[model samples]
Target: MRTVADALHDRHRDQLKRSQLQAHPLLTGCAPWVIRRVAAVADEVLFPPGELLAEQGRTPGWFLLIRSGVAEVARNGALLGVVGAGDHYGEVPLLGRGAHPATVRAITPVHAWVIGAQRFVPLVDDVRPIRETLAASLAAQPALVAAARAELASRIQSMRREGSNTWPGIRPPRRRRSVRVLHVLAAIAMFVAVAVGAAAMYHPPYAVIRPGPVVDVANDIEISGAAVHPIHGRYLLVMVHTERPTLLSFATAAILGHHRPVEHVTALGGQPDVERQLHGQFTKSQQDAALAAAAALGIRPSASGALPFTVRFRDRDVVGPSGGLVYALAIEDMLSGADHAHGRTVAATGAIDPAGDVIPVGFVDDKAIAAQRAGAQVLVSPTSEVYLAADSGVRVVGASSLREALDRLAASN
Candidate 1:
């Protein structure tokens, strides 16, 4: 048998060969020897939906190249853009020795290839075409390029307008002699100024802005009816019967705040006793324990005369917990009179801390898919957990706090 060190070297060599095949165009054209050299220092990554790929403003340890699936890019709750298959992202900071400009989230389950900076930087020095292509691509993107051009034009115009030079061939019209004419002119100028100001305030270009608090109201209520359990089954199917649909509504709303919204709750019929199943079968003791746990969680038989209700707050039309922050914030904002649901379906997922920070929860990908199915358009998510919001084709925003999510909804409305 080969020695342990020899086996490790063989495994590493195989990994390097794989990396060489996935390298970008410039690197792709390199000789086999060079490719092998680069691959020796590369790493591979696989991220499921809702996994964080990278954070904003942090120096990246690896140069990331997406091999498959989509990733969302955002900064301060505003979506920057999407990075899809075969794309190279997260290189800006690495190349410039600057802070990361945005956070990268996996929008779909992803497979990526990574090269450490120490090895990648030296390769870039020899690959001039790669550097040129990257620079050109960055400069050509419409959003960034257009903004830069507009700013440049505005500055030039300002310099001209503010310059002291007089027109070479034209003179100002002599002052009007009539007071009525002067009054009319002054009124016209004032009207024009007001119009300009209003336009500027109301029609600001649609640049991404930081999100605000989210608030949603109980729009309607529905009851979750009864469920039957088989006497011999391993798990007990217990229906969560509630008099106030708002309680379930709030839970659903909170779910929507962080993830995309589902068109409707899957109507799973009843809650399954997962713990009992793990024990192989439900005994008398297991049933009692399950009941006790449910009771502690406030799930019990409804009292007489308790009306069944279902309240639809807003639907993100996607499934997942990525929008939890937005949903919770929407509820709070509505309660505080700071916002109203303008009839747009909102969806999100995440767990809300008492202090209003959205904590990462589970099932982000499924939650986004469910929310999309429900027709939710605006998705709010915690900044830390948005990678789970991938590939459902819904627009997603990231919020650092509950307040930020509410503000995003309020402003959008």
Candidate 2:
């Protein structure tokens, strides 16, 4: 018995929910489509004063985004803080916590838009910006973070206390009577341990790519047998950390959502000897960079082989040709005696050929995160990979060749 007025009213309510989601401060960086998806799953709820919105030591069921009123966040009677409109909580549970770290109680009549864990956890696992925003929010609250850590210890102590007094009136069983039970329990424990060990050792089909350390090229590079010129700013070489995911790690990533996983074949390019292949590419890239630098500077290579100058990078476990563009820029900058970077921090990633053409590299988004973390102001990437880092919160410059990269850096303020 639904009327047209009821249908119109429902539609209006739905649109209002979407609008509220769009205006959320923490979700401002998220894509429109992601917000739409979240809005579709969100439900409006009201909590009375002194009501527990989320209880400590209980499994999380919903993620709340407050629209009005206020709530108190606490851990075992210790108040963490008060959150009102535009503030959020209930994320610690989504991050693989078996229980809620803190209790959220309504300080006043609370109104919020809530998404159940079934919907919210997947959204966080799929969307990178949402995860980053939530992580930053949690990090900004030091007291809440400490309470979360203490929650684990509190649970352990409570568990011990409960178990310790459970058999107060019962006498201990005789050793002879308990021998068979003990042996069976021991066998079961051994079997479980072996199974867990085997699962941890087994490799999954996916490999994870994560951001690695960013090295400032100006300070880390050594130039021997050449006139090294001083520069005013730093050039950074960004790297990625790769891991072959085991069952446990793969499952953890699937549940928690901070790491990205790709097919193993795609990651290593079906190479049998990944280390040697990457190392060879690294060596060739250095040579090509030096040659390109010399050619750009109008210097002919020595009769021996290449230029008389040698460029050596600090010893690092990272092996890849993606640093070629940065190396060439650093060498060219030093040899040309021009301050290309001026007074800004520049980070770059791309493979380079002897002719100074910049080749596209993989994982530029991850590299961009590393650059931002290292305080880089500008990131230079191949034209094809520039869009990958567009949302990485850093100024990205796309270049097709070495000359273009140099020109952009020199022109940028």
Q: Give the candidate number with the greatest TM-score.
A: 2
Regions of candidate 1 where Cα sits further than 4 Å from its true position: 1-16, 19-26, 127-129, 135-413
Give Cα-based local distance difference scores for all models. 0.49, 0.77
Task: Compute each candidate's TM-score over C-alphas.
Answer: 0.33, 0.49
- Weakest 10 consecutive residues, lDDT, candidate 1? 233-242
Clashing pairs in 2: none
Model 1, range 196-279, lDDT digits (tens) per residue?
656544522111111222223233111133331211101101111112132334344445663222212111212122222212
Alpha carbon deviation, residue 413, candidate 2 (Å): 2.4
- Candidate 1: global Cα-lDDT? 0.49
